[model samples]
Target: MSAARSSGTTRVVILGGAAMGSFCAMSLRDQGFTGPITVVERDPSYARASTALSAAGIRTQFDTPLLVEMSLFGADYLRQTGEIMAFREEGYLVLADAGRAEHRARLAEMQTATGAEVALLDRAELSRRFPHLNTGDLACGTLGTRNEGWFDAWSMLTQARARAREAGVDYLTGEVTGLEAQAGAVTGVVLKDGTTLPCDWCVLAAGAHSAPLVAGLGIELPVVAKKRTAFAFRAPVDPAGLPLTCDVSGFWLRPEGQGFIGGIQPPPERDDHPPEDLEPDHDLLLDLFWPNLAHRVPAMEELRLDRTWAGHYEMNMLDQNAVIGPHDRFGNLVFCTGFSGHGVQHAPAAGRGVAEWIRHGAYRSLDLGPLGWARVRDGQPLSEGMVF
Candidate 1:
């Protein structure tokens, strides 16, 4: 845990030290990156982070094996939460509408391939398993039997930051205004104050802000700020045994302390926004989310609405999947943004995979080639059916 800078040492500068950045920094230390690491974060409060604003849920009930596999690894990390970050396990459930029988079957097939403990429950079984739930409209549901659920995202991320600091990661409060490049190699970064910190490599993990940041270096990333809203409800029924459930319709809810918190994707036009400070419209819950929730679960009619908040999804225009690995053209700059809504859940594995790619020049653990920059250029649509 030494910051002793030596001549010709590989200094790595990371952008945005919230969940993704902090996890990336922790991964670097865990992978034995001994060079000076400086994490520049614009908002240390992390109030607007997708990590904090997320439903804080985890699940392996995804369509793609990579995603399910990544969450499986993430679940293990969450299981060892006490040793790594120390948090409680709440759990997650994915509800499927009668129309989504095909999608449910496909997901179950993928989960089985990965050996994930995702149980495909019929309407009767789902109603019995989750007695509090009104599964009248549900044809089936995929429940994470054991190691799947929601957690204290803020506490987990904060603990990752603490561990990264313990491992010699410097957390600097500043906005990265510019990058220092020499002959197609990243030399350092320029802060808002015009002070330049030289580095051998740079990681653009700036979430929504990453688009403009990378564009500054002539790298045109299609990452846009897609507005998403989240609302909490203090339901009449106890949410104790309830798992974090997402209606196949994309509206999701999970138990948070005494109440349950959740949200749905906004309509198309309302989804895209400029990268700026915008507030959450709680009416999206009543106008959009509630109607759908009621349709999915009849008992949601009795659920009382509580406090709500909103955040931006660093949505990728081309495909909803994340953009990992280095910029194909800019060899020195690594791009780890555009995870859309799945960033928080996939942060641990994504962070470690990118860190490994950075240190070893290839992904030694999980081959994240599906999320590579080549797909963006080749116009390949990823086979991600469940994008919410």
Candidate 2:
């Protein structure tokens, strides 16, 4: 289909319709852009989309000031769930060991500077606050007292999709097979079904599947799929009101329905590139997560495995941070990919930032220059220390 056949306004083609793409379309409308926005998504069910598969936690506790600011805004956006979807403000707890005291303190300073309501608690305070946790080896921990926690990602995406459609955005079910470029700028995209979508701008937010789509255009995004698993279980005792807690060992858990869900990152040597199949490694949960949980929460020693699922994290090789903004050479082609594991929490700010840049030729709300593609192009890595 030609651009005119698709729609009759300033054309914008987004390559994915999950969290990032859906939010981008909504942001464009919210920014007074009455253009023909087409979101091309291969999987509308989003069963395999990162957003739907995520643990769906949002937080303002981050090591970097930019991430802290972005997530702070994201938490605010999520607080509108009463108008979007059901959400929780259960908060997040990030624990630090003795060796990480300095690092945690520095991050706490940055988070405070960004006006995040995060409190640094000593081991005694952590023990007193969450008596179930074993804080003997912990030096300190940061806890978000407000505007943090998990929510229904699919619900948010669904609401955003509906709002975008109501605002004249087009949802196209197709796969972008190739990009059509001229004079070092992307003019449009070609779908696998031989449909051509001409656009004034294109944003790639395809998550793990983004690299192959842009590789043909000579763009190398340092993103790769790394499998992470989540297990839902029933603890022997009720751990109600438990916050999303992260251990210094990388193990984490939080409340889910009547029970709890949690997981631990496999050791570096075992964190291999995930296969096409998203099969959960039950043994990893049994051998790793179970033991870790048992050690942290004595009541969890008798937890019963309810179920498990695996999802991919689009790991950024250079610095494990997001790469946003327009491509240096292809100015018309903007990027909102390589969010690593922060996509769901940072989607709102990122989408708004991208839309603002597209509409006003600069970021009007937040300065996201630190996450621009220029960092990758200039061989400068903006490493984010908080990867969990």
Candidate 3:
């Protein structure tokens, strides 16, 4: 596959080489962009990359139509994971209690309108479909019957990186320390080792560290790092046929290998800002997660904790959704950060959209207008209720 010739100079410098960066590079190549694409990554091992540490669930059960549409594309993209990475269609079940029944129904209407394969299941239907679950306190549930599940995100990222490299994309190991901007347009990026890489276009995809990087350019993105922990446990009974179930209490669990992996959303008032460390929070698991699991699944009452790990969500505090597209001021600098945990699933579509924008000066495939930074600048945040 030969790279497409660009109309003008298009030397792109991506600040992160994880899932989003690699996928963006692949998308550019796939879209016939023959520009020099350089991806700068500090950690090539991806030991702490959010894509490698994510729960890796993909679904179309979003409250907004745009999100549903993006995730639907993501699910279809993951269907080809057999050639790129490992994937499984175990399905996802989102439970809604009486308090959120109306909201859940509204979301279901929107999801169905967007061509999502989601069904609103009553309590009896939920129990019939998932007998292992305890749906006694639920009013209704939204179940993704098809094109939804989990996959090995690390494998996908690695495969994408390898493909991008094979396609002539340069993968450089360095940390971007500064950006050189002239007359509101980025001109070059400076590495920590005092090396300058001049770029015609710059992309900020540094995950949780993107906020500080953009701040250096006088952009105020309301993105912060929020820590989320996933606990692995072994239940007394087999969790076969069990879908990734998210209870009304914001705690979610799913079958992983011979056991299960799960986590819970922290309370709204709780400060989730933690140090840049991936230390598992044992207290959160033993205190909050276990109790919720026991209440939702009685078999989990006798479950034993196997292990635990943590990661950061590049949370968009402005709206809990993604902030994509080019910057309002710097047209040459693209904004691909602030996914707030949806980066892994939406990377394929986002990368394609960004590549299209760079190639044709517009989003030719998926309409990502709703996720632009203009809304953030205007104080008009798009409401995305499904933030777990």
Compare the candidates by TM-score and give the number of the best one.
3
Of candidate 1, the 10-residue stretch with the lowest lDDT total is 1-10
- TM-score, predicted candidate 2 vs. hidden true structure: 0.95
Which of the two candidates, 2 or 3, achieves a greater TM-score against the reference? 3
Query: 9-128, model 3: which lDDT tens digit per residue?
Result: 569999999988998899989988888999999999988888989999988887768888888888888886675545677778999889988888888888888988888999999888
Q: Scored by CA lDDT, what does every candidate get?
A: 0.78, 0.85, 0.85
Off by over 4 Å in 1: 1-8, 83-90
Per-candidate TM equals 0.92, 0.95, 0.96
**CA displacement after TM-score superposition, residue 326 of candidate 3 (Å):** 0.5
The residue-level lDDT of candidate 2 at 310 comes to 89
lDDT of 1 by residue, 340-380 (tens): 77778788998998788777777888898888888887888
CA shift of 204, model 3, Å: 0.7
lDDT accuracy of residue 242 in candidate 2: 78
